[model samples]
Target: MAAENIEQENSKVKYLRDKLEKAILEKCPDSRLNGDKENRLPNTTNISFEYIEGEAILLMLDKYGICASSGS
Candidate 1:
Protein backbone atom coordinates (compact mmCIF):
# COMPACT_ATOMS: atom_id res chain seq x y z
CA MET A 1 0.00 0.00 0.00
CA ALA A 2 0.99 3.60 -0.52
CA ALA A 3 2.31 5.80 2.27
CA GLU A 4 -0.97 7.61 2.42
CA ASN A 5 -2.81 4.37 2.93
CA ILE A 6 -0.26 3.27 5.47
CA GLU A 7 -0.57 6.54 7.32
CA GLN A 8 -4.32 6.20 7.37
CA GLU A 9 -4.09 2.72 8.74
CA ASN A 10 -1.68 3.93 11.40
CA SER A 11 -4.14 6.62 12.30
CA LYS A 12 -6.74 4.02 13.16
CA VAL A 13 -4.16 1.87 14.88
CA LYS A 14 -3.00 4.77 16.98
CA TYR A 15 -6.48 5.52 18.19
CA LEU A 16 -7.00 1.98 19.36
CA ARG A 17 -3.56 1.89 20.89
CA ASP A 18 -4.27 5.11 22.71
CA LYS A 19 -7.55 3.94 24.10
CA LEU A 20 -6.21 0.60 25.17
CA GLU A 21 -3.19 2.18 26.74
CA LYS A 22 -5.23 4.69 28.68
CA ALA A 23 -7.61 2.06 29.90
CA ILE A 24 -4.87 -0.31 30.89
CA LEU A 25 -2.85 2.32 32.63
CA GLU A 26 -5.75 3.62 34.62
CA LYS A 27 -7.52 0.36 35.25
CA CYS A 28 -4.49 -1.81 35.78
CA PRO A 29 -1.87 0.40 37.23
CA ASP A 30 0.08 -2.53 38.59
CA SER A 31 0.67 -4.15 35.22
CA ARG A 32 4.07 -3.85 33.65
CA LEU A 33 5.90 -5.57 30.86
CA ASN A 34 8.35 -8.17 32.11
CA GLY A 35 11.69 -8.56 30.33
CA ASP A 36 15.15 -7.29 29.84
CA LYS A 37 16.06 -4.58 27.31
CA GLU A 38 16.50 -6.90 24.32
CA ASN A 39 13.21 -8.78 24.65
CA ARG A 40 10.82 -5.94 24.10
CA LEU A 41 9.08 -5.02 20.88
CA PRO A 42 9.30 -1.39 19.87
CA ASN A 43 6.03 0.45 20.23
CA THR A 44 4.63 -2.86 21.35
CA THR A 45 3.30 -4.19 24.62
CA ASN A 46 3.24 -7.18 26.92
CA ILE A 47 1.73 -6.34 30.25
CA SER A 48 -0.38 -8.06 32.83
CA PHE A 49 -1.82 -6.97 36.12
CA GLU A 50 -2.45 -10.64 36.61
CA TYR A 51 -5.81 -9.85 35.11
CA ILE A 52 -7.85 -12.93 34.42
CA GLU A 53 -10.69 -11.23 32.58
CA GLY A 54 -8.62 -8.58 30.84
CA GLU A 55 -8.25 -10.54 27.64
CA ALA A 56 -11.51 -9.00 26.58
CA ILE A 57 -9.73 -5.63 26.41
CA LEU A 58 -9.06 -6.24 22.72
CA LEU A 59 -12.77 -6.65 22.07
CA MET A 60 -13.56 -3.51 24.03
CA LEU A 61 -11.92 -1.29 21.45
CA ASP A 62 -14.25 -2.49 18.72
CA LYS A 63 -17.19 -1.24 20.73
CA TYR A 64 -15.57 2.19 20.75
CA GLY A 65 -15.21 2.45 16.95
CA ILE A 66 -11.62 1.28 16.80
CA CYS A 67 -10.28 -1.83 15.11
CA ALA A 68 -7.14 -3.45 16.47
CA SER A 69 -5.09 -6.60 16.23
CA SER A 70 -4.58 -8.73 19.30
CA GLY A 71 -0.80 -8.72 18.93
CA SER A 72 -0.90 -12.19 17.57
Candidate 2:
Protein backbone atom coordinates (compact mmCIF):
# COMPACT_ATOMS: atom_id res chain seq x y z
CA MET A 1 0.00 0.00 0.00
CA ALA A 2 1.11 3.57 -0.59
CA ALA A 3 0.68 4.49 3.03
CA GLU A 4 2.71 1.51 4.12
CA ASN A 5 5.57 2.49 1.86
CA ILE A 6 5.47 5.99 3.21
CA GLU A 7 5.58 4.69 6.75
CA GLN A 8 8.54 2.48 5.94
CA GLU A 9 10.41 5.31 4.35
CA ASN A 10 9.67 7.51 7.32
CA SER A 11 10.98 4.88 9.71
CA LYS A 12 14.22 4.54 7.79
CA VAL A 13 14.65 8.29 7.71
CA LYS A 14 14.01 8.54 11.44
CA TYR A 15 16.62 5.91 12.18
CA LEU A 16 19.15 7.61 9.93
CA ARG A 17 18.47 10.97 11.54
CA ASP A 18 19.01 9.58 15.00
CA LYS A 19 22.26 7.97 14.01
CA LEU A 20 23.42 11.05 12.15
CA GLU A 21 22.63 13.36 15.06
CA LYS A 22 24.62 11.28 17.51
CA ALA A 23 27.54 10.98 15.14
CA ILE A 24 27.55 14.68 14.34
CA LEU A 25 27.48 15.63 17.98
CA GLU A 26 30.33 13.32 18.83
CA LYS A 27 32.62 13.79 15.86
CA CYS A 28 32.03 17.48 15.28
CA PRO A 29 31.87 18.91 18.72
CA ASP A 30 32.59 22.64 18.94
CA SER A 31 31.91 22.91 15.23
CA ARG A 32 29.86 26.07 15.69
CA LEU A 33 26.46 24.66 14.79
CA ASN A 34 22.97 25.87 15.45
CA GLY A 35 22.24 24.76 18.98
CA ASP A 36 18.48 24.30 18.88
CA LYS A 37 17.21 23.88 15.38
CA GLU A 38 14.61 21.24 14.59
CA ASN A 39 13.95 18.78 11.76
CA ARG A 40 11.44 20.17 9.30
CA LEU A 41 11.13 17.07 7.13
CA PRO A 42 8.93 14.25 8.36
CA ASN A 43 11.78 12.11 9.59
CA THR A 44 14.96 13.82 8.39
CA THR A 45 17.31 16.37 9.98
CA ASN A 46 18.71 19.68 8.91
CA ILE A 47 21.71 20.92 10.82
CA SER A 48 23.48 24.17 10.11
CA PHE A 49 27.16 24.26 10.97
CA GLU A 50 27.90 27.90 11.57
CA TYR A 51 31.42 28.06 10.24
CA ILE A 52 31.00 25.56 7.40
CA GLU A 53 29.49 26.27 4.03
CA GLY A 54 26.23 24.32 3.51
CA GLU A 55 27.55 22.95 0.24
CA ALA A 56 30.27 21.23 2.19
CA ILE A 57 27.62 18.99 3.70
CA LEU A 58 26.89 17.69 0.22
CA LEU A 59 30.49 16.61 -0.18
CA MET A 60 30.26 14.71 3.06
CA LEU A 61 27.11 13.00 1.90
CA ASP A 62 28.74 12.09 -1.36
CA LYS A 63 31.64 10.62 0.55
CA TYR A 64 29.19 8.48 2.44
CA GLY A 65 27.33 7.32 -0.70
CA ILE A 66 24.12 8.98 0.38
CA CYS A 67 21.66 10.54 -2.02
CA ALA A 68 19.72 13.15 -0.10
CA SER A 69 17.53 16.07 -0.89
CA SER A 70 18.48 19.68 -0.46
CA GLY A 71 15.73 21.54 1.29
CA SER A 72 14.04 24.43 -0.43
Candidate 3:
Protein backbone atom coordinates (compact mmCIF):
# COMPACT_ATOMS: atom_id res chain seq x y z
CA MET A 1 0.00 0.00 0.00
CA ALA A 2 1.18 3.48 -0.86
CA ALA A 3 1.76 5.88 2.01
CA GLU A 4 -0.74 8.71 2.12
CA ASN A 5 0.69 12.23 2.19
CA ILE A 6 -0.60 15.67 3.02
CA GLU A 7 0.50 18.60 0.88
CA GLN A 8 -0.58 21.45 3.11
CA GLU A 9 2.05 23.12 5.34
CA ASN A 10 1.21 23.26 9.03
CA SER A 11 1.72 26.87 10.04
CA LYS A 12 0.88 25.96 13.61
CA VAL A 13 4.11 23.98 13.81
CA LYS A 14 6.18 27.04 12.93
CA TYR A 15 4.17 29.20 15.30
CA LEU A 16 4.69 26.81 18.19
CA ARG A 17 8.37 26.39 17.33
CA ASP A 18 8.92 30.12 17.41
CA LYS A 19 7.12 30.40 20.73
CA LEU A 20 9.14 27.55 22.21
CA GLU A 21 12.48 28.91 20.96
CA LYS A 22 11.68 32.33 22.34
CA ALA A 23 10.66 30.96 25.70
CA ILE A 24 13.75 28.77 25.99
CA LEU A 25 16.18 31.50 25.02
CA GLU A 26 14.57 33.90 27.46
CA LYS A 27 14.21 31.55 30.42
CA CYS A 28 16.79 28.77 30.11
CA PRO A 29 20.15 30.42 30.48
CA ASP A 30 21.88 27.08 30.87
CA SER A 31 20.49 25.61 27.69
CA ARG A 32 22.62 25.58 24.57
CA LEU A 33 20.44 25.61 21.48
CA ASN A 34 21.85 23.40 18.73
CA GLY A 35 21.18 25.17 15.49
CA ASP A 36 21.41 28.44 13.67
CA LYS A 37 18.17 30.37 14.17
CA GLU A 38 18.25 31.69 10.61
CA ASN A 39 18.73 28.21 9.11
CA ARG A 40 17.12 25.52 11.21
CA LEU A 41 14.79 22.61 10.72
CA PRO A 42 11.28 23.82 11.44
CA ASN A 43 10.31 20.55 13.10
CA THR A 44 13.51 19.97 15.05
CA THR A 45 14.63 21.66 18.26
CA ASN A 46 17.70 20.25 19.94
CA ILE A 47 19.08 21.63 23.18
CA SER A 48 21.78 20.54 25.56
CA PHE A 49 21.19 21.42 29.16
CA GLU A 50 24.45 22.20 30.86
CA TYR A 51 25.03 20.49 34.23
CA ILE A 52 21.82 18.48 33.84
CA GLU A 53 21.16 14.91 32.83
CA GLY A 54 19.51 14.54 29.45
CA GLU A 55 17.46 11.57 30.61
CA ALA A 56 16.19 13.47 33.61
CA ILE A 57 15.19 16.39 31.48
CA LEU A 58 13.45 14.09 29.02
CA LEU A 59 11.52 12.43 31.81
CA MET A 60 10.38 15.77 33.18
CA LEU A 61 9.31 16.96 29.74
CA ASP A 62 7.45 13.72 29.14
CA LYS A 63 5.41 14.32 32.27
CA TYR A 64 4.34 17.62 30.77
CA GLY A 65 3.30 15.94 27.46
CA ILE A 66 6.23 17.23 25.46
CA CYS A 67 7.65 14.56 23.16
CA ALA A 68 11.44 14.80 22.92
CA SER A 69 14.42 12.54 22.36
CA SER A 70 18.14 12.64 23.03
CA GLY A 71 21.14 11.36 21.10
CA SER A 72 23.06 10.63 24.29
Candidate 4:
Protein backbone atom coordinates (compact mmCIF):
# COMPACT_ATOMS: atom_id res chain seq x y z
CA MET A 1 0.00 0.00 0.00
CA ALA A 2 2.78 2.40 0.86
CA ALA A 3 4.59 1.63 -2.35
CA GLU A 4 1.43 2.22 -4.32
CA ASN A 5 0.91 5.58 -2.67
CA ILE A 6 4.44 6.64 -3.48
CA GLU A 7 4.04 5.58 -7.08
CA GLN A 8 0.85 7.56 -7.37
CA GLU A 9 2.52 10.64 -5.98
CA ASN A 10 5.38 10.29 -8.44
CA SER A 11 2.96 9.94 -11.31
CA LYS A 12 1.15 13.09 -10.28
CA VAL A 13 4.39 15.00 -10.11
CA LYS A 14 5.49 13.82 -13.53
CA TYR A 15 2.13 14.71 -15.02
CA LEU A 16 2.22 18.24 -13.62
CA ARG A 17 5.81 18.70 -14.72
CA ASP A 18 5.07 17.67 -18.25
CA LYS A 19 1.99 19.86 -18.40
CA LEU A 20 3.95 22.87 -17.18
CA GLU A 21 6.72 22.26 -19.68
CA LYS A 22 4.26 22.03 -22.51
CA ALA A 23 2.51 25.21 -21.51
CA ILE A 24 5.75 27.17 -21.22
CA LEU A 25 7.04 26.02 -24.58
CA GLU A 26 3.76 26.81 -26.25
CA LYS A 27 3.72 30.32 -24.83
CA CYS A 28 7.40 31.06 -25.44
CA PRO A 29 8.73 29.69 -28.67
CA ASP A 30 12.19 31.13 -28.01
CA SER A 31 12.49 29.43 -24.63
CA ARG A 32 14.42 26.20 -24.16
CA LEU A 33 14.29 23.55 -21.51
CA ASN A 34 17.49 22.72 -19.67
CA GLY A 35 18.81 19.32 -18.55
CA ASP A 36 17.64 15.86 -19.50
CA LYS A 37 13.90 15.68 -20.02
CA GLU A 38 13.48 12.05 -19.06
CA ASN A 39 16.22 11.54 -16.50
CA ARG A 40 15.82 14.55 -14.27
CA LEU A 41 13.81 14.84 -11.07
CA PRO A 42 10.06 14.73 -11.63
CA ASN A 43 9.36 17.94 -9.72
CA THR A 44 12.10 20.14 -11.14
CA THR A 45 12.12 22.09 -14.40
CA ASN A 46 14.82 24.42 -15.71
CA ILE A 47 13.94 26.62 -18.64
CA SER A 48 15.86 29.44 -20.28
CA PHE A 49 14.24 32.18 -22.28
CA GLU A 50 15.93 33.98 -25.09
CA TYR A 51 16.50 37.76 -25.07
CA ILE A 52 15.60 38.12 -21.42
CA GLU A 53 17.65 38.37 -18.25
CA GLY A 54 17.03 35.49 -15.85
CA GLU A 55 16.88 37.71 -12.79
CA ALA A 56 14.32 39.96 -14.44
CA ILE A 57 12.12 37.04 -15.19
CA LEU A 58 12.30 35.76 -11.63
CA LEU A 59 11.41 39.17 -10.30
CA MET A 60 8.38 39.45 -12.54
CA LEU A 61 7.22 36.03 -11.52
CA ASP A 62 7.61 36.97 -7.87
CA LYS A 63 5.35 39.96 -8.38
CA TYR A 64 2.66 37.53 -9.48
CA GLY A 65 3.17 35.38 -6.37
CA ILE A 66 5.18 32.75 -8.21
CA CYS A 67 8.20 31.28 -6.48
CA ALA A 68 11.21 30.79 -8.71
CA SER A 69 14.98 30.66 -8.33
CA SER A 70 17.99 31.47 -10.46
CA GLY A 71 21.31 29.65 -10.64
CA SER A 72 23.32 32.74 -11.33
Question: Candidate 4 on 1-72: residue-level lDDT in tens?
Answer: 878699789889999999999999999999999988889888889999999998899999999998888882
- 1 versus 2: better TM-score goes to: 2
Best-matching candidate per TM-score: 4
Question: What ordering of candidates by TM-score runs from best to worst?
Answer: 4, 3, 2, 1
Tell me each candidate's RMSD, in Å, in order.
5.6, 3.7, 3.6, 1.8
Q: For candidate 3, lDDT tens digit of each residue in 1-72? A: 223332234355667788897798789898877868767656677777888898999899999998988783
Write model 1 residue lDDT over 1-72, tens digit each, in one string: 477587677667666655666787787777665555344434555555555445586578678885556455
Task: Quantify all predictions' global Cα lDDT against the true fold.
Answer: 0.61, 0.67, 0.76, 0.90
Q: Give the worst 10-residue stretch by lDDT in candidate 1.
A: 33-42
- Report the lDDT tens digits of candidate 2 across residue range 1-72: 878699788878877877877798778865533334454564655555656666777788889998755454
Over 4 Å off, model 4:
1-4
Clashing pairs in 1: none
Q: Name the weakest run of 10 consecutive residues (lDDT summed) in model 2.
A: 31-40
User: Which stretch of 10 consecutive residues in model 4 shows the poorest summed lDDT?
Assistant: 1-10
By lDDT, the best candidate is: 4
